[model samples]
Target: MSGLGDLVARLLGRSRAPVVVEDPPPTAEQIADAVRDVEARIEGRVPAAVTARVHRITGTVEDMVPRLDRFGVGDRQAYTVVATATSYLPEAVEGYLRLPRDFADRRVVSRGKTSLMLLCDQLDLLAVTLEKISDAVYRADAQALVAHGQFLADTFGQSSLDHPGPGAP
Candidate 1:
């Protein structure tokens, strides 16, 4: 039995399996673009109401800065409200929320250790939002959208990872 186990282990270890460090799943921009493409392909198949709601929600967020900034809270807190409110919107709204900003080219990519830290910060914000939101369905959707946005922002470009910093990809 020991010999057999050893043989199996050796075989497994020796197998030159392509060491695939799956480059962290396609960034959110990638996913959002795919979703939009599918929506476009389907054309009128997706409900008009859903599309309308998504547009409306995005419009609301686009104009939210004044109200959010007026409260004297930090960007993270303001983002929290944005994330939560987005959850209540329709799925289409949630889908569109994943779209990357037009200015992704401006972000600076941190290599190695710095990249790791920024990645950790992104994950922490995601976890925190999940824990804070009460509604399960909404929570899940919001987290997904938030994660997508973070990825898109990162892919596009981010100036800062800390408080009062520019938004994440």
Candidate 2:
């Protein structure tokens, strides 16, 4: 039966396993460039609120690139950084920008909120999420620092407390 199935697949020019082609995950530099492009795309085109939130998100993204190793290439945070740069942030801004300013800011699109209001909410969410990622990265680094400090103290039997100031006897 297995041989018959393989014969049928071969006759149809197919394979036993479906081919899956997934794009390689974006690198830190690619993510950085993408976020920068998003920022540039929205510059002077959006209101102050949108611009401010974008800045907040971009700033965290910039800070996160140097520490991306904390999350590793395949981590969710890494995916998020890439998505925010390549898709999420750009889509949100462009969706709003595509609307006429007066209509976007004035017309209630959903939940009794205008497009501008909705965009602000989206931007705020992105900013907070990126901030949380940044905090997590730093927290990991801080833990590593503490461990290294403890290792030094244990190995040397000395700590900064053991060193006296110049005025000490």
Candidate 3:
């Protein structure tokens, strides 16, 4: 059948295949909801240092959500990174949090805590990386802006461990 004939048939009766549409990227609120939920779940249970890291991580995500639009990603790469970080980290944290603190299986609790610690570290890096990416965006095409690493350190007051160290070549 011709294109016009197919259209007419679909309009009148219907087509067999379903139509698909692209899902809109998550909004800042949706991202904030998951991040904050994880924060609430883990409150006061972890060591003070770990708690501080979680606080910093969640704060960075909160900051990144609104400023995502200003990122120079141009492609969907930026959104994908932010969405994956926010979604995966929170779910993993929630899983760890959901485990009973006094569970009989010491081995299971140990493993869960270990995994949560690792996930929290990864989440920290992810948030810092997003901020660095966004920082680069603001620095783009601007003469006075310093390099990304510098910008990140200046804004966040510290660089990720993965970044070049102060004394490193």
Give the candidate number with the greatest lDDT.
2
Residues 27-82, candidate 1, lDDT per residue (tens digit)? 33443344444345435533454444334334434444334534344446554545
- Best-first order by TM-score: 2, 3, 1
| C-alpha RMSD for every candidate | 22.7, 4.7, 12.9
Query: Against the hidden true structure, what lDDT does model 3 obtain?
Result: 0.65
Instruction: Report the lDDT tens digits of candidate 3 across residue range 1-169.
Output: 6788878878987765577888776767888887777778778765565577677767767766776776565556466446654676666566656666444213343446555455556667766776676566556735345575577777888548667979989
Model 2 residue runs over 4 Å out of place are: 3-18, 159-169
Candidate 2 similarity to native, TM-score:
0.83
How good is model 3 by TM-score?
0.58
- Output the TM-score of candidate 1: 0.25
Candidate 3 lDDT at 164 equals 94
- Tens digits of per-residue lDDT, candidate 2, 1-169, equal 9899988997888868676899877788888898899888888888898999998988888888877776655789877876888899989998998999999999998999999999999999999998888888888889999999999878988666789978899
Question: lDDT of all predictions, in order shown?
Answer: 0.44, 0.87, 0.65
